[model samples]
Target chain A: MQHRLCFAPLNGLILLVSACVLALPMPASAQDKVLRWHDNLDRAAQASRESGKPLFVVFRCVR
Target chain B: MNGVDLARFEFDYDTTWQAFFLDANLNVYSRYGGRDEKSADGRHSVASLQHTMNEVLVAHERRRRPESRSDADLQPAPRSKTTPEDIPLLKAGHQGCVHCHQIAEYRALQSFHDGKFSRDSIFGFPLPDNVGINFDLAHGHRVDAVVPESPAAKGGLAPGDVVTRVDDVPVRSEQDFRWALHRVVEKRSVVVTALRAAGSKPSQPVSIKLDFHADWRKTDLGWRKSLRSVPLPLGFLGYALGREERRTAKLPDGRLAIKVVSLRGGGLAGNLGLEKGDLIVSLAGRSDERTLDDFKSDLLRRYAPGDKVRLTVLRDGKSLELTGPFPPWDTTDTSVP
Candidate 1:
C-alpha cells in the first residue's frame, strides 16, 4: 500500500525555517534509485549540452 | 560556499519538492510539482512526473523545427540578486551545500529589503485546495477529493469529477490548475467546469462556482517561491510552538504563539531588538487566539514593507509590547544578513 503524505496542518513558515537547521541538500542519487540524478546544476547543464536531452531537475530538500 | 542556480527556473518555493523539465537552451517545457501546507507531496505523483517527462521529450522534438519556437518561448528568465557566496554567514564558515530554505530566506529578505516585496512576489503559487479541490494527477488531473463545505463542494464538486477547465483555460495538468488559480486573488470567484462520473455511467458536465476570501492568496505566501526578479518580505526566522509546548508554557487555550528559534545575524528581527527565546504572542494587534498560519497570512497580505507593526512578546514570564519600523525591503542592499 502506498502511504500518501498529508500536509494539511503544517505551517509553511515553520517548514521553510526548519529546513535551514534540520535539513541538508543531498544528492538525489544518494537516496532515489528511480532516476540517475545530478547534484549540480552546471554539471547537468553541461551533460544536457552534450546529449541534447532535456534536463530533469528536481529542486528539493533532503529533510 | 557559493550561490548557484538560485535564479534558474521559476519554482513554487513553498513546496518541498519542485521538478522541472527544460531544454538545453533554458526553455521550460513544463513543470510537475504542487504542494500545500498539509502535505509535502500535494498533487505530485510518480505517474504525473513520468508523464511530464514524456511531454517534455516531445516538446524538444518539436522545437527542432524553426517554426516551433515563438517569441514567448525565447524569452529569458530574470536573474536573482545576491548569490550564496555573497551571504556573510555562508562566506564566513558555513560549509556543505546551501539548503533551499537558506536560499529562500536570503532571497525573500533581499527582496523585502529592496522594497519590492508585493502581493504577487510574496504570494505567488497558491495550492489547489485554496478552492477546496485536490487533483488526482495520475488520472489525467481528475478531481480526487473536495474539501467538505469548501467552495468546490459548495459549487457541486464530488470525488471522481474530472476538471476540464478552470475559468476559461483548459486543465490538462497540475500546472494548468496553478495557472487558473494564479489569477484568483483576494476576494474573487472563478468558474470551474468538470466532468462527473457516477459509477460505470457516462460522465456528466458539472460546473463548480469557486470564490476565495480576501486572505485566500495569503494562505501560505511565505512558502511561495519568489521569482528571480521579484522582491520579498521580512527576513526573521521563527517557528510556531507545538500544541503540547503551548500547553506546557501555561498559556491560555487556543492562543497562537510563535517562539523565536533562530535569527539570521543582522536579520530584520534581530536588528529590531527581537531576540531568540522571545515568545511572540501578537503582531499588529493580532493575538494568540488566531492560528499562526492565519496571522502570518494577514500580516503579509495586508501590510506592506516599512509599515510600523506593534509586537507583543512574552519574555521571562513577563508580557511586553514593542513597536518598531518594519524592515525596508530593498533587494539591492547586499549588506543584509
Candidate 2:
C-alpha cells in the first residue's frame, strides 16, 4: 500500500509535466513549417522554384 | 537590397514598406503596397493582402497551364538588370548601405545635373484618388466609391465595379493601377477598363475614358521623404501656430501664422536673414488659412528656382519684410548628401 501511494504521486507528477510541456508555445523553427520565411532572396527564390509557388518580396525601410 | 534588380523591381522609393508578388523566374506578377498622405497604413489591410495573394496564385497557375503558352501576359518583359551599384552618383555618395529614398534622391540629382530634370519628377506614384476613384480596402482593385462629378464618375466608373486595366496595363491591384497612372506623362484622356456583374449573368467588360487635367498628379508632398532631394529648398522649417498662439499674436482665425523655429545654415531663409523666432504672417503678400504642408506645396507650385519671394515676418512687436531670390535649382554640387 505504501509503494502504491508513492507510485500514484509519481504518475500524477508525470501527467502534470506532460500537460505543461504540451501547453508550451511552439518553437519558431516548428512554426516556420506553416509559414516559411527567408531573409536571403536567393534561398527564397530557390524555394519558390522548387515548390512552384510565387515569391512575395517585401522591401521595408525600417528607418 | 544592394544587389536588387532595380530595372525589374521599381516601386515608390518614399514608401517605408512595399511588397512585390513575383514568380520563380523573378517575373513580377503584381505589386501589393502603396500609401497616401492620409496615413502610412491607411491604404493597406490584411484582407487586401489576402485578396492579392489569391489573385497572384490564380495568375501563377494560369501561367503554368500548357494551353496558356501563347498568353502575352505570362511572358516576362525584356529588361536590362540594373542595381544600385550601377548608379555612379549613388556609389560615389554612400559606402556601405544604400537606402531606397537615396536611390530616388541620387537619381533626381543626377537628372538635374544632366539637365533632364522636370519639375513633375518630384511627384511620384500618385494615389488613385487623384483620378477620383477610391479603392476598396478589402479588394485593392475594386471600386468602393466614386466621387460624384469626378473624372471616374463622369467616365462611367461606379462603386462595385472591378477594375481590370488602366490604359491597357492589367491592374491586378491598387498599386498596379497607380503604376499605370504614374506613367501618364501628359494631361490627356486615358482608358480605364472594368468588369461589371449584373444579377446572375457573366461579368461584362466596360471601358471608360478618364480625362486628366494639369496638376492632377499633385498630392500631399509633405509626407514624401524624397521631396527633400528636390532642388526647391525651403531653408527653414516652419511650425504652424495653434489657435491659442494665433490669438496671442492678434492674428485672426483662418490666416497664415507660421512660426519659424529653425533655419538651415547657408539656406535660402538664412540668406534672407530670417530669424529663428520670427513669426511669418504672410507669403508673397497673401495670408491664408494653410497648414505647414499646404504652405510648402504652394511655395513649390508657385515659385521656381531663381524666383523672388517676399515674406512678412512679425519680429518682437513690429512687422518686417524678408525678400530674396531662390538659388538656381541646378546649383547643387557633386557633394550632394
Candidate 3:
C-alpha cells in the first residue's frame, strides 16, 4: 500500500524540518519515485508569460 | 500534474531532464544531513530530509494523478502546499530568497490583508478589523471544536479534549496562547503539555511534537495567486507571517503609525485592534519595541488553544485599544502543494 504524504512549499526546507519531529515520518520507501529539480523549464521561470501565473512545480513519489 | 499526465502531455522525447535532476539532487542531499545540530540541530534532521522528498513526490503525483481521472474538470486536483518553492516560478529563476525569509518578507506584505501589493494598486481584499483565536476548552481534544486539525491534529489531538498548557504555561486566555507561541521561536516541534478531558478529572498530560503548516492565514492576509495567468516571479504569493493585529511604527514624519494586520483572526495582532497599515509608535505610553526580536522571541512560541491577550495600536495616526482571544486551529491546507 502506498501511503501518500504532503509537505511544506520549501523544496527541502519543510521536509528537513519535519524530519526532525514528525512522529512517524514520511518514509522514503513510502513512495519509490521523487521530484528532482533538474530544470522542468517552467520551474526556472519567475512568472508565467502566458497565464500570468507563477509555475507550481510538483514532484511525485513513486512507490 | 501526475507523472502519467506529465509524461502523456509531452509531445517530444528527452530523457536528459530526468537524469540531470536525479544527479543534482544526489549532490544537494549528500551535502545535507538529517541530524546536524550545528546545522539542522540534532532532532530528526534525516527524518526531515525524508519528508521533504516524500512531499515532493506526493505533490508531483497529486498534480499529475487527476489528469488521468475519468472526469477531468469535474474532479478538481487535490490541493498543494503554498510555500515559496511551490509557487512554480514566482520569481525569475534568478532570485533565491535564502536570506530574506519570513521576517524579511514582512515589509513587502504591508498591504497584504487588503490585497494591495502596492499603495497605488486599485484592488485589495476586504480585511477584518481584528483577528483573534479562541481556545477555551480542555486539552487532549474532548471537544471536536477545540481540536485544530492543523497543529493539534498533527500533534495527535482530536476534538473533545483539554489543554492545560503549552510548554508548561497554564493557558488561561488568548494572550497567554500568543505568549506560548512566541516562546517556541525556533522549535520545530514543541512539548505540548495536554490533558484529556474525557475522564471525570483531567488525564495525564501528553507531550508530542508535530509538523504543521506555516499558519499564515492566521496573520490576516490574502495569499493571492497572479491576477493574470502569467507566471509570477514566485508562487504562493501572500504575507509570510500573515499580519499582526496592531504594530506601532515611526513614520518619516516622526509620527507614531499604528497598523493593524487583523483582529478577526486572533492574537496580539488582533487583541490590540491592530489593523492593516496602522502604525504604533508606543504601547502603554512606552515606545519599547524590537523589530527582529519580536519576530523570533520565545514568548511568541506559546500560541495554542484558549489564549488571551491585550494590545494597543495606532490607527490613522490615533492610538486604539483592543483585547481578544486566540484559540487553537483547523485550517484549509489547500496551499499544500
The C-alpha RMSD of each candidate to the native structure, in angstroms, is 9.3, 11.1, 18.6
lDDT of 1 at B225: 40
Count the clashes in each prediction.
20, 0, 133
Which candidate has the highest DockQ of all? 1
User: Candidate order by DockQ, highest to lowest?
Assistant: 1, 2, 3
lDDT of 3 by residue, B223-328 (tens): 2212221111111111212133232233443333333343444434534445665544543344444332232121233233355534455566575665555332
Q: Which is the better candidate, 1 or 3, if ranked by lDDT?
A: 1
Best by TM-score: 2
On residues B208-253, what C-alpha lDDT tens digit does candidate 1 reach at each position? Answer: 7886765566555433343332333344567777778888898776
Return the TM-score for candidate 1, rounded to 2 decimals.
0.55
lDDT of 2 at B326: 63
Spell out the clash pairs found in candidate 2: none
Please, what is the TM-score per model? Answer: 0.55, 0.79, 0.23
- Ten residues in sequence with the least summed lDDT for candidate 2 chain B: B69-78
Residue A46 CA error for candidate 3 (Å)?
A: 34
Error of 2 at B141 (Å): 1.0
Please give, as one word, the docking class of candidate 2. Answer: acceptable
